[model samples]
Target: MSDPLFEEDEVPTWIFTFADLMSLLLVFFILMYSLSKMTETTLESALSSIQIALSSNGANINQSPRFYSGGGSKLIAPETPQLADTQDLTFSEEPIDTEEREQVNEIANDIANKMVSSNLSNAVSVFEDGEKITIRVDGQTLFESGEAQLSYEAEFIFNKLIDIFNRYPEYSISIQGHTDNIPINTVRYPSNWELSAIRATTALRYFLEAGFRPERMTATGYADSIPLVRNDSPENRAINRRAEFVLQKDPDLQKLYGK
Candidate 1:
C-alpha cells in the first residue's frame, strides 16, 4: 500500500550510516597523508614533544574552552631547559678499543722483558690499563735523594726507551713525577712541587734532546697528591716516589679502526 504522494526512489536508513563511516575514513587518510609529508626532523621533534608531555607531571589539560575555541587541537608540551651551545657536555675520556688495548699490552710486555734482560727489573715496572701503558721507574734508580740529576744507569735506560719511542712515533707520551709525603725545602727546590716538576722536566728534556716531537710529549708532577701507598713505611714511601711514562691512545684512530 504505497502512498501516491511518496517518491519511488526514497533513500534507505543505512545510507546515512555509510556516509558517516566514509567521512571518518576520509579524515583518517588525510591525517596520515599530512604526517607522511612532514620532514624527518619535524616528525622526530613532534614525537619527542609528545613523549615529554606524557612523562611530565606539569601538563595541564584543564584549561578553559577558550584555549581551543579556534577549531584547532592543542598539544601541551612543556619546554625543557637545554644546555648552552658553548657548554661542553662531553668532558669524559673515550673508552679504549680492543685493538688499542692489545697494542698497549704488547708494548708493556716488551718493555717488561727489556727491563728484565738488562737486569733493571727491580728499578722499573710496566703496567697497562685499558686506555694506556704506564712504565714506572723507581726514583732512586734515576735520582739520588733530594737530587734531580739523572744517574749513569738512568741515562742508559732512557736511551733504550728512546729507541722504543722511535719505533712508535705516533703515540702521545706523558711523563709524570711523583714524590713521597716527606716535606722538603731546599735552596733549589722550595717545595715538593718544585722538586717533582723539575724531575718531570728533566725526564722530558731527555726525550726532546733525543729528537722526539715536542708536540707529542707532556710533563707533569703529582707532588705526593697521587701516591701508590699510604707512605706509612720506608718501603711504601720508596714505592710512592717514582717517575711514570704513560702512552695515550688516539681517539679518532680508535674509532676508525672499530673498537
Candidate 2:
C-alpha cells in the first residue's frame, strides 16, 4: 500500500500544461481584438507624436508611417491637408463712376499725346483710375540722385503740365514725391522724408510761380512707403523713385479757378 502523503500529492501533469496553453490563447485573442479596434485617428495621432519625437532627436525621417491590422492588412497614414492658395483667388475692387472715368481717360489721353509730342513719353506715364488721373514722372528725369533741385528737363515738363492745368481748372492737383529704400543723410536732407518733401515743395513752387492757385494744390512726401512694385531689383527701385501729379475733380476748386 502507498503512503497517505504520496497519495494526496499525486496530480495530472498534463492538466497543468493544458491550463497554461489556454491562458496563452486567451491573452493572444485579447491582443488581436484590441489591435483590430484601433481607429485611423488614433493611429494617425500616434504617428504624429512619433514624428515629433524623431524630429526633436534630429532624425531625418520623411516617409509616412504604416500600421498593420489583426488581419495582416497594411494601413498607411493620411497625408496632411493642403491650404488654399490666396494668390489664385480673385478680389472685387471699388466700383468706378462711368462719366468720371471717361473724363479722366480723356485727360490721360491728352497728356499721353502731349508727352509723345514733347519727346518726354519715356520719362512719364499717365494712369486713370475712377475719378482721378495720375501723371507719374521718373525721378531721375527731373532731378539728380539725392538732390531736391529740379533739372532743366523738369522745367520743360512743368511748363507742359502747367499748360494742361490751365485748361483743367475743374481739377485739383496733388504733388506726391516717392523715393527708393536707400538711406540718405545730409545737412539739407536728414532722411528720405526731408528729401521727398523738399522735392514735392519744389515742384509746388514751380506751379505756384506759373500762376496756378496755391489753394488748389497740395504737396506730400511718401518716402519708400508706397511702391509700384517690389523694390528687389534696380529697375524696380528706379520705378519706385518717382513724382506723381494726381488730379482729381474738385467742385470748389472749379469755382476758385473760374471753371
Candidate 3:
C-alpha cells in the first residue's frame, strides 16, 4: 500500500518546525541572560569599543550619544561646539621669541604681585605657559550666587586688570566664564549657559568701558563644561565656578604696532 521510497518510521515534517521554535526560544533566553549580566559601564565600554572599531574601518559616526530624560518625551541634545571669540589669524611654525616669553613671565609676576597686594592671593591665581598667561579669579569674588552682576569688589580687581592689559597692548585677551554643575533656571537665565554668557559679556563690557580695544579681546562662556575639579563636593564646585583671563602674545599686532 505504501510507496517503495517511503519509510514507515520516517520523521514527521512538524518535528522540524517544533525544533526550530525551541531553538529560537533558547537563543532568546540566552541573549536576555547575557544582557542581564552586563552592567551599565560594561555596556558603555562595549559600545565604545564597537564605535572605535567602526571608526577605524572608516565609517561615519557621530561621537555624541543621544540622551533621554526620565519620564519625559523630550530629547536632550548634546551641546554644540563653540569657537573662541577671536579673530582668525594665521600663525607660523616659528618658535616664540625670547623677549615675548620673558614678557609673559613678567606679566605673570605682575599679576601675582597685584593679587598679593590686593589681598586676593587666595582667591586668584596666575599661570604662565610659554607665551600664554592666565589669570583665574574665583566666582564668589566676582558675582553673587546665581547672579551675573559683578559685585562692588569686582570693580577694584577689574580696574587692576585693565591697567595691566592696557600696558600690554600686543596681547590678545579672552575673558572666559565658567560655572559649576548646579542647575540654574530663572526668568532671565533659563540655563547655566545663558548665565555664564551674560557674566562673560558683562566683564567684557566693563573692559570696553575702561578704554580697552574691542578688537584685541574676546569673551566666551564654557557653561560648566570645563571644570577645574569634580563637582562632587561644595568646595570642588566652588573651585570649578570661576572666571579666567587668558592672554596670548599677538605677533601680528606686535609687528603692526612696533611693540
Which lDDT values do the candidates have, in the order given?
0.72, 0.76, 0.76
* lDDT assessment of candidate 1: 0.72
RMSD of 2: 23.9
- Looking at model 3, residue 154 earns an lDDT score of 94
Question: Residue-wise lDDT of candidate 2 within 1-259, one digit each (tens)?
Answer: 8787667655889999999999999999998998899988666666655543343112322222333222223332222223224332122145667876787788889988999999999999887766778899999889888788899999999999999888898899999998876556567777779889999999999999989888889999988777676666557768878999988888897677675
lDDT of 1 by residue, 156-223 (tens): 88987897777666667899998876555557777679889999999999999989878788999878
Displacement of the residue 14 alpha carbon in candidate 3, Å: 96
The segments of candidate 1 whose C-alpha lies over 4 angstroms from its true place after superposition are 1-93, 251-259
Instruction: Give the TM-score of each candidate.
Output: 0.60, 0.63, 0.63
Candidate 2: deviation at residue 14, Å? Answer: 99
Task: Tell me model 3's lDDT, rounded to 2 decimals.
Answer: 0.76
Pull out the clashing pairs in model 2: none
Ordered list by lDDT, greatest first: 2, 3, 1
Flag clash pairs in model 3. Answer: none
Q: After superposition, how far is residue 193 of candidate 1 from its true place, in Å?
A: 0.5
